[model samples]
Target chain A: MNSRISAFLADRLPLKNVENHIKKPLPKHINWLFSLGSMAAFLLILQAVTGAFLAFYYSPSPDHAYDAVNYISKEVLFGGFVRGLHHWGASVLVIVVFLHLLRVVAYASYKPPREMTWVTGVLMLLIVLGFGFTGYLLPWDQKAYWATVVGVKIAGTAPVIGDFVAKVLRGGEEVGAVTLTRFYALHTIWLPWLAFGLIAVHLFFVRYYGSAGTPKNTPEDMRSGKPFYPDQLFEDAVAILILFIVLASMAIFVPVPLEELADPTDASYDPRPEWYFLFLFQLLKYFEGPLEVVGTFVIPTVGFVLLLFLPFLDRKEERTSLLKRPVALTVTCLSVVLIMLLTILGAIAPRLEPVPEQPPAAEQTAPSQETPEKAEEEAVFDFGLD
Target chain B: MTDVPEEGQQRRTFFKIGMAAIGGLIGLAMAIPLVGFAISPAFRKASKKWVDLGIADLLKGSRYKKINYTFSAKDGWVETNKRRSVYVTDQGDGTFQVYSRVCSHLGCLVRWDEGKDQFFCPCHGAVFDSAGNVVAGPPPRPMDKLPVKVEDGILYVKES
Candidate 1:
C-alpha cells in the first residue's frame, strides 16, 4: 500500500522535490526559539479555520451583530469554544510574531540577504495588528465600539490627510452600521488575503536564504547540523503541540466574554484598546492636543521605519552576537521595557474619579437654589449625598 | 510538415473563441449576484425615526426620571429591537430637558448624582451639571441632549 501510494504521488507531483526541501539540514543552534515562527504560522492556520466557523454565524450589521454573536456563544454547538480559540489564537499570534522578530534580531538574522525576510516579517506583524483591530469591532460590543471610536479618532489626529484617513476607516463621520460592516469585511477578507500573501513571500525568503544559526554555535557545531525533518521539525512539532494544548485549555476554562451591544449614543463608556495596543493608548495620555500628533503618528511612524530599515542601519561584518552589539541591544531592551511599562500602567491606571454619591430622591426633586460658586464647590467637594 | 487544412484550422479557431465567449458569459452571470450580495451593505441607508416614549405627564416637576423606549431598527436583512434611555428633567415651568445617559468622553452610561447636582460617569470621572454642561474630568464635551417634543400629551424623542 505504501509503495502504491508513493508511486501514485510520484506520477502526479514532484515528491522528490518536496523531500529534498524538507530534508535539508538546519543549523545545530536552531532550537525552540527558532520554533516561534512556525508556531505563528500554525496559529494563523488555526485562526483562519476558527474564524471561518465563526463567520458562518456572525452577522455584520450593527443591529444583529451582537445578537448573532450571542446566539453563537449560547446556541451553537461548541461555538463558544471556536470563538474562544479564535480570540486567544489572535492574541497569541501577536506575541508569537513579536517573539519571532526578537529571536531574529538576537541572532542578527535580519542581516545581509535576509533583509527582505525581515521586512516581510515586520509587514506581517502590522498585518497581525490590523487583524486584531478589525476583529475587535466584529463582536459589536461596547468595548469594541468605544475602542474603535478612540482608534479612529487617533487616526483622525494625523497631520495633513488625517480627516480623510479617519473618514475612510470609519466609513462615515461616526462609528455606525457602515463602520461595523467595513471592519467585518476587512477582518474577514482583505487583511487575511494580505497576510497570506506576505506569509508566502516571507516563507520564500526564508527558504531562499536559509536559516541563520545562533552566534554562540561553534564552526564544528554548525558543521554537524541535523536534518530538518527529524531534528528541527521535531522540536517545532513538539512546540506546536504544547501550544495547541495551552490554547485548548484556555478555550475550555477561560472563554472570551461578550459585553453589552454597542450604543454609540452612550457617552459614559470608557474606551480602552486591546492589550497589545495599550502601549500606544498609554503613550497618547502623555501628549495632549497639538502634541497628540506626535504620539499618534510621528513616533509610531518613526519607530516602524527604523525597524524596517534596521538591517541597513546596523551594517556590520563581525560575528552576530548581542554582547558585541551594544546599540542594537540597548535600543531593543529599551523598547521592550517601555512597552511593558506602558502596558502595565495602562492595565492598572485608575479612572479619573470614583462614582459620586447619589442624593436622596426627595432632595433631587427640589430645585437647586445655590449660587453658581456654591454649585461648583459642591460638585468638587461633595462626595457625600445631600 | 505539411500545412494544416484551412477549414480545420478555422473550425479550431472558432471553437476556441466560442469557448472563451461562453466562459466570459458564465463568469459575468456568476459575478453579478455574488458581487451585489457582497457589497449590498455599503449601499444601505440607516433606518432611524422618532420613537415615542409615552405620556409627557410621567415626566412632571423638576425631578429627573429615567425613561426606556424600544424601537425596531433594520440593517440589511436583520431587524433588532434597540433599547434607548434618556434622563428627562421637567423644568417645572413647561419646558423639558432630555439628556442622553451616555457619557461624552466615551459611550458608558452616566447616572444623575442628585447630591452633587450633576451627572456622574463611572467609566471616567467626568461630571456634568444638571444642565448637561461639562463640569469636570476628561470629557471633551457635556452629555448629549436628545431632541424631545410633546404632542397631545405624548413625549417623543428623535433617535438615530
Candidate 2:
C-alpha cells in the first residue's frame, strides 16, 4: 500500500529531481569539518521551532514582556527547556557559522564559481547576528534594556547618518515601547524572511557548483567523489546528533536567566552587549571623540566589505592549500586572535560602582501643570498611539 | 515598409513604458505607507515636561541631591510611568544646577559618588566633576544640564 501511494504521488510530482538532489555527490576528502554548515542549519531549525513555541506564550509589550517570559520559564511545562535551547542555540549557531566560514576560508572555497555562495553566506551570518541582537531585548529585563540602550547609542556615534540610525533603531529618542515592538517585529518576521531567501539562494549556489573539494584533492579524486547519500549524509547526521545532544543537555541543565524588570530610572545599572558583540564593544573603548567613528563605523564596515570582496581580492587561481596561502591564513589567524582577545577583555572589564544611598528629599505638595495623566494623553495624541 | 518596422518598434516601446508605469505605481502604492509606518518614530518628538522636584527651600543644599521623578508618558501603545533621576545642587546665587544622570558618552546613567565628589559612568570609566565638567575617561564633553525654574517655592526641572 505504501509503495502504491508513493508511485501515485511520484507520477504527478517532481520526485525524480528531489531524488537526484538527495543523492548528490560530494568530495571523498571532506571530513568532520565539512559538517559545520549542516550543524548550523540544524540549529537554525531548532531555533525556529523553539522560538515559535516560546512565542505562543510571549507578549511583546514592555509592560508584559518580562512577565510573559517569566511565566514561560517558571510555569509552562518544558518551557524552560525550549527557552534554554533557544538561548544556547543562538550562541552555538554563531560558533558553528563562524567555523563554517573559517573552513571555507581555509579551503579557499570562496574562489571563482563559489563567490556568490560566499557572499550569501556572509549575509546570512549578519542576519544571524541580527537575530541575536533583536532576540536579546525580548526578555525586557535590566540586562536586555541596558544592552539595547548602549547598542543603539553605539550606532549613534557614527558620523553624518549616526543620529538617524540611532533614531530609527530606537524608534524614538529612547529605547522604549516603540523600540520593543520594532525589535520584536524584526526578530520574528522581517529578519527571518530575509534570512530564508538568503539561505535558499546560498544552498542553490552550493548545489550548482558542487563542493569545492579539499585543496589536496587531485582532478581524479574530484572525478571519483563519493555519493552524498550514505557517506556525507551519515557524517552530517552524526555532527547534528552531537550538536543536538550538547544543546539538549545544556537546555535541561542550565535554566535561562531572567533578571529584574527593566528600570530606566536605575542609573547604577551598567549596560553590556551580548557575548557575540563583546569584541566590538571592547573595540569601541580604544577610540574617543571624533575618532569614535573608527570603532563604531569604519572598522566594522571596512571589515565586512573586505570579507564580501575577499574572493575578488585574492585573484590567484593556482593557490588553494592553506600552507601555500600565506596572506589568507595570516589574515584569518589575526582576526580570530584579535576578536577572541577583545571579547575576553570586554568580559572582564570593570563596571561603574554603585553610589551611596541618600535620605529621601521633601515631596512637592503642589501639582505641576503637566500632570501624569495629561502628559500621557498628550503623548498618545502626538505619537498616534495604537 | 521600412517605416512599418519603426512603427512596430515604437509600439513595443510604448507597451514597455506602459508596463513600467504600472509596475512603478504598484511598487509606490505598497512602499509609501510601508516606509512611513516603519520610520514614523524617527520623526517623533519626545514629550517634554517640567517635573516638579520639590519646594525651593528644601532643595538649597551644599552637595548635589539625587531626586527621582515620575511622569506619565506614552511608550508605543502603553501609557506608563517614565521614571528618571537627576542630580540637582543649589548654586548659592538663587540658581540651581540640574545635571542629567545620562552619561554623555553612551546613554548609561551616571551616578554621583560622594567619596570621589564626581559623577561616574558605569558603562565606561567616565568621570564628571561637581560642575558637570568631564574629569577623565571617554566622555566627549561635560554632562548634560537641564533647564530649571523656581516658581512660588516649587522647583521645576524641564525634562525631554
Candidate 3:
C-alpha cells in the first residue's frame, strides 16, 4: 500500500497543469497535414453542441420541418448563428479530415503502431460522410429533398444490396414522414452515439502511441528522446484552446441560415448538398449506367480498400525519409490531385438543375389562322374544361 | 541526489515561459472585443441614424406613400437607406387606425385600391379587405403592423 501510493504521488502530476500543457516544444517540421486531426475533432464538438441545441426547436414532420427551421432563425434568439455554424461546420470538418488522412499517408505516419489510427480515422471519415448525407435531408427543403432523391437513386445502383440500403435510408419507397423521422433519429441519436463510441476507439490509439511528432526521417527515431507526457500534451492543449476561442467567436456571431421553409412541393428550387459532397456527385455524372456502377461503388470501395493496405504494401527496408523514394512523392501527388479534383467537381457537378419551366407556352396565340367560329369553339373548350 | 540546474530547477523555467505565452494569447483574445466595444460609438456616427417618420395626421386613408429613413449602426460602414409606407383610416371614434403598406405575404409593396375597396397584390393576385384581412386569393397570412408611439403630437416607429 505504501509503495503504490508513493508511486502515484511521485508521478510529477504534470498531466494536469497549464504549464505542462503549453510549454513543451514540438519538432519543427510539423506541417498543415499534422494540424487537421485536431481541427477535425474540434469540428465534431462544434457540430454536436450546436446540433443538440437546434434539436430543441426543430420538428420532424414533413409540413413543419421547414417552418420550424425558419421559425428558429427568425423568431428564436441566436438561432440563426447556431444553425449556420452547424452547417458550415460540417463542410469544413469534411475538408479537415481529408487533409488529416492525406498527411498520414504522405509522411507515412500510419506506419507501425499508427496503422490502426489511420484505419479508425478512415472509418471516422466515412461516418462523417454518413452524418452529412443523412443530415442534408433533415431540413426537408426543395434542394435537400431533390438532391437526396438523386443521392438515394445512386445508392440504389449498388448491385445486390442497393434496394435494401436505399430502403433503409429512406424508410420506404419514397422519402416521406418516415424518412424524416428516421433521419432525425440517425442525426440526433444513433449516429452521434455510434460516432462517440468510434471516436473513443480512435482516440485510444492516439493516447497509446502519443502523437507521431513528425516523419521519423532519421536513425535517431531508433533511440529514446523525450517522454510524450509533457510535450505532446502541451501541443494538444494549445490546439484545444484555440479551437475553443473559434467556437466562442462563431457562436457569438455567424448564426445559421433558415431559408423560407423546406417545401417538397416547391419543385422550382434546385437541390444541392453542401459543397464537399460535390466530387461524389460529379463522379456519378461522369459515369452513366454500367460505368456509373463502377464509378460510385466499385471504384470508391476498391480505392478505399487499397488505401487501407498501403502501409503493408510499401514495405521498404527503411523508415528513413532520405531512403524512401517513389512512395513519398506518389503520396504527395495523390493528395493534391484528389483535393483539387474534389474541389472542382464540387463546383461543376450537375445538380438537379431547376427544370426550365416554360411559363405555360404563351396561351397558344389563339390560333390566328382559324375562322372566328372555330376560335370561338376553342375558347369555349378552354372555359368548359375549367 | 541528482545534479540539477537549480532547486525548482528546469521545471520552474518552463513554467515561467509557459505562463507568459499563454497570458499573452488570452489577453489578445480579450483585447480585440474590448477595443471594438470602446470605439463602437465612433463607428455608429460614421454610418446612418434612424429617422423618425412623423405623426398620424400627415398620413391618409387609401393612399400609399414611401417614406425613407437611415439607421446608424456601427463604425465606418454606414447602413443602406430604408423605406416604408403608412396607410391610415378613420376608426369613427376620433381615433385613427394605421398599418404599413408592406405585404406580409412576400414583402411586395401592397397597393390600396380605393375603387375596389381592397388591397391588391400585383405579383400574386392576393386581395385584402379594408381591414387588411385576406378576402380573396393566395396570401397565407395577414399584413404586418408596425408599432408606433405618439409624443407631443409627433409619431415614432419602433425600429430594431
Candidate 4:
C-alpha cells in the first residue's frame, strides 16, 4: 500500500528531487552552531504564525491602534502569548542572524561559489531590521511614535534625497494616521513577502552548494561524512525544539508591556529606539552639524556596500581559517566590538529625564494625565523586546 | 530560395518584439497606478493653519512658558486633534518671540533648561540659547522660530 501510494505521488510530482534532498550528504563535523540557520528559520515561521494572529485583532488606524493592542493583551485568549512570541522573536532573530553571519565569516563559507549566498544573507539582515523598524511603530505607544519620528528624521538627513525619503516614510510631513497605516502595511505585507523571496533564493544557493563544511576539511573528507536526514537534520531539529521551549517560556512568564498612548507633543518624553537600533543611535551622537550625513548615511551605506561585495574583494581561495586571514579576522572582531560598545554606551547614556513609569490599564487612554508614582517597575526591562 | 530562411527569421523576430511589447504594456498599466497609489501621500502637502494660544497675557513673564495646544486637523482620512507645543517668551519688549521645540539636529523635542537658561536637545546634546541660536553641540542652525502674531489679545502661531 505504501509503495502504491508512493508510485501514485511520484507520477504527479518530482518525488526523486525530494528524496535526493532528504538523503543528501552532510559534513560529520557539523556542530551545534551549524544549527543556527535552522533555528532562525524556525523563529521566522513562529513569527509569521503569531503575526497573522495579531493582524486578526489589530486595527491599523491610529484611532484604534493602542486600544486594539490593549484588547489583545487583556481580552483575547492567548493574545499576549502570541504577541510576546513575536516581540521576543524579533530580538532573538536579529541575534541569531548576526551569529549565523559571524559563523559563516569564521568558516570562510562566503568564498567563491557562495558569493551570491553571502549577498542574499546580508540583504536578509537588512530586511529583518526593516521588519523591526516598521513593527516598532505598530504599538502606537509613546516610544513607538517618537522612535519612528527619530528614525524617519534620521533617514531624512541623507543629503539630497533625505527629505523625500522622510516624506515617503511618514507618508507626509508628520507621523500621523497615514504613517501608522503605511508602517502596518509594510510590517505585515511588504517585509514578509521580501523576506520570503530572499529566503527562497538564499536556500536555493545553500542547497545547490551543499554545506561549506569546515575550512580544515577537503571535499573528499566532507563527502565521507554522514547523510543529512538522520544525522545533521536530527541535530537541527533538537536545536530548534530547545529554542522553541525557551521562547514559549519567555512568552508565558513575561507579559509584554503596553505603554500609554503616544502624545506627539510631549516634550518631556525621552525617546529611544529599540535595542537593535541603539548602535546607530549612539553613532549619531558623534557626528553632528555639517557632518551629520556621515553618521546617518555615508558610513552605514559604505559599510553595507563593502559587506555585500566582500567575496569579490577578498579572493584568497586558500585563506579560509582565521589564522590564514589576519585582516579579515581583525576587521570582524573590531566591527563586532565597536557595535557592542556602542549599544552599551547608548543604553547607559543619560537622558534628559527618565521616561515616566507606565500607567495602569485605567489611565491608558487619557494621555494628558500624569502617570501614578506607584507604578509597576517590572515593565522597565520591557525596553528591549522589539 | 535563401530569402525564405531570412523571411522566417524576420517573422520570428517580429513576434518576439510584439509579445514583449504587449507584456510590457500590461505590466506598466498595473505598476504605474499601483506605485502612484502607494506613494500618493508623499507628494501631498499638509495644510497649515494659525492656531491661537488664548491671549498674550500668558507670555507676560520674562521666562519662556512651554504652552501646549491642540488643533483639529484632517490627517489622511481621519479628523483628529493634533497637539503641539512652542516656547513663548514676553521678549521684554512690545513684541513676543516664539521658538519651536523641535531640535534642528534630528527631530527630538528640545526642553527649556531653566537652570542653564538655554534649550537642550536630549537626543544628541544640542544646545540653543534663549534667542534660538545654536550655542553648542551639533545643531547646524538655530532652533526653529515660528511666525507669531497677536490679534484681539490672542497670540497665534502657524502650525503645519
The candidate scoring highest on lDDT is: 2
lDDT by residue (tens digit), candidate 4, A53-91: 677768888888988788767655566767787899999
Q: Write the per-residue lDDT of candidate 2 for residues A1-386, one digit (tens) a residue.
A: 99999999999899999878866767657778888988888788777867766777778889889987887676555667777888999999999999999999999989887899999999999999999999999999999999999889888977789999999999999999999999999999999899889989998998888888788777667646666655566567667766777887898898788889999999878888889999999999999888988998899989999998888998997647776889888999999999999999999999876643441132122326667986664443343222
Q: Write the per-residue lDDT of candidate 4 for residues B15-114, one digit (tens) a residue.
A: 5565455446534633443344334456767888899977887667646788888999965444699998888888877678888888889889999989
Tell me the TM-score of chain B in each candidate. 0.69, 0.84, 0.54, 0.88
Task: Identify the runs in model 4 with alpha carbons over 4 angstroms from their true place.
Answer: A1-4, A354-386, B1-160
- Residue-by-residue lDDT tens digits, candidate 3, A27-127: 44554445567678867976897787777767888877887677656655555656766787787787778778766765667778677887788788888
TM score of chain A per candidate:
0.92, 0.91, 0.78, 0.90
Candidate 2 local lDDT, B43-119, one digit each (tens): 76787989898999988874678888998886643468999899889898999999899999999999999998889
Q: What RMSD does model 1 have?
A: 21.9
Query: For candidate 4 chain A, which ten residues in a row score worst on lDDT?
Result: A377-386
Worst 10 residues of 4 chain B by lDDT: B29-38
> What DockQ does predicted model 3 obtain?
0.02
Going through the candidates in order, their DockQ values are 0.02, 0.01, 0.02, 0.01
Models ranked on lDDT: 2, 4, 1, 3
- How much is A367 displaced in model 2, in angstroms? 40
Query: lDDT (CA) for every model shown?
Result: 0.81, 0.83, 0.67, 0.82
Backbone clash pairs for candidate 1 read: A266-B107, A267-B102, A267-B103, A267-B106, A268-B103, A268-B108, A269-B107, A269-B108
